[model samples]
Target: MKSILLSVIIIIIISSSCVNKNNSVQDKEEIIAVLNQQQKDWSNNDLESFMDGYWKSDSLYFYSGKKLKSGWENTLNSYLKNYPDKSYSGTLKFTIAKISAITPDSYFVMGEYNLTREVGNATGTFMIIFKRIDGEWKIIADSSC
Candidate 1:
């Protein structure tokens, strides 16, 4: 009887672990999809849609150049000011360098962003922290150089 109970307990533990691992993989894929969509939106000059990947919260943080911006509204405003038109917005591309789970519900992503424009081209690296919020992966913090 004791041996049977122990065997059952071990099986339960193993099953739970497997389920967790599967969920982690799914989460990673979902996060990557969000990033890809953002890139696509940017390329299309749809800033509003691209911002969908970011957390729509007052506490959302974005760091670019030497300035730190807080709140979704502020970030949106900054983007508008910087890229007011299609020519300024240019075409955006992203190359994901690394993505790892920080916790069950949080992930860290490092990538390179390139903007090709008729005026000039710019390239930089970015690191973003994503959190599972309301069943969706959203960027909670972004640091782009």
Candidate 2:
């Protein structure tokens, strides 16, 4: 009985270690790719495509400058309201200053965002939380600072 219990403990530890390692590597690559795609889609001024990088469920949430926006539709509507035209959309440019994995399947990303438009250049900093869900990386929760 003691030997069986010991074996189970060893197995559990090894399994957890492997899971953490795999999740760490995958989370890093997935988050970077998702962020990169966001910039690409924004630069193209494709709102629909840009939103694809985000978690599309009803639970998806975002906060900007103290304003909390919940759900995918709300976020999309806000974007459309703000950037109605291509000129307003401008070209999305981002510099990822830092990205840290907070857990095996979660990350905290901080970056600077800029838009070059006919009117002027608008810039801001953003901090977003990304989570891996069902083997895909999604922005489960986000807040722009």
Candidate 3:
């Protein structure tokens, strides 16, 4: 009986260790899903829905083109002011270069964004940090240039 109990313990530990090693796969998938939804939201000119992926807190940070914005509301305001409408907002497409884990609950994504609009087409690289908060993943910081 003791030997059986010991074997079970060993199996449990081994299983847990294996799960921990590959846990990032699940996280990556979740992050990708969020990005996909954001892309769809932006393409539909749903800025509010796009912002749903961001951490709705005063600590949220955003930086882009000689502008620095802190707080979720400020970031949303910036998007509203700059984009204004679908014509200006354009369709946002993201080509992810890499997604690296910063911690168990945090990751930094580097990618290129392309905007298709009648006014002009714009492209740039961006680095955004996502952190798991309140059982959901949210963008805590964004730097686009």
Candidate 4:
């Protein structure tokens, strides 16, 4: 009887492990797909669509250069101010270096971004935190240089 119970426990653990592994892979793929969509949105010069990747809340955080801002609207306004138009915004390309899970519902991504434009080209590195909220993954925090 004890041997049977032990076997059952082992089988449960193994099954649980497999489920967690599959879930983790699915989470990563979803996050990567979101990033890819953001790249496409930017390339299309659709800032509104690009901003969909970020958390649409006042608690959202963004830090870059000497400025640190909280709130999604503030971040969007900054992007508009800096970029203004396609020539200023350019074509965005992201090279993701790593994406690590912080929790089942959260992740951190480190990557490099390049903007090719008529004005000039700019390259920078960034780390962003994404959290699953309302069954959707949204960037909650970002730090870029």
**Residue-by-residue lDDT tens digits, candidate 1, 23-132:** 98898899989988988888888898999999999999999989999999999889988988878889998899998989999999999999998678889999999999
TM-score to true structure, per model = 0.93, 0.80, 0.88, 0.96
Against the true structure, whose TM-score is highest?
4
User: Candidate 1 — worst ten consecutive residues by lDDT sum?
Assistant: 80-89
User: Could you tally the backbone clashes for each prediction?
Assistant: 0, 0, 0, 0
Which residue runs does candidate 1 get wrong by more than 4 Å? none
> For residue 40, what is the lDDT in candidate 3?
92
What is the lDDT for 113 in model 3? 95
Per-candidate RMSD vs. true structure? 1.3, 3.4, 2.6, 0.9
User: Where's the lowest-lDDT run of ten residues in candidate 3?
Assistant: 17-26
Cα lDDT of model 4 overall?
Answer: 0.94
Model 3 clashing residue pairs (backbone):
none
**Lowest lDDT 10-residue stretch of candidate 2:** 21-30
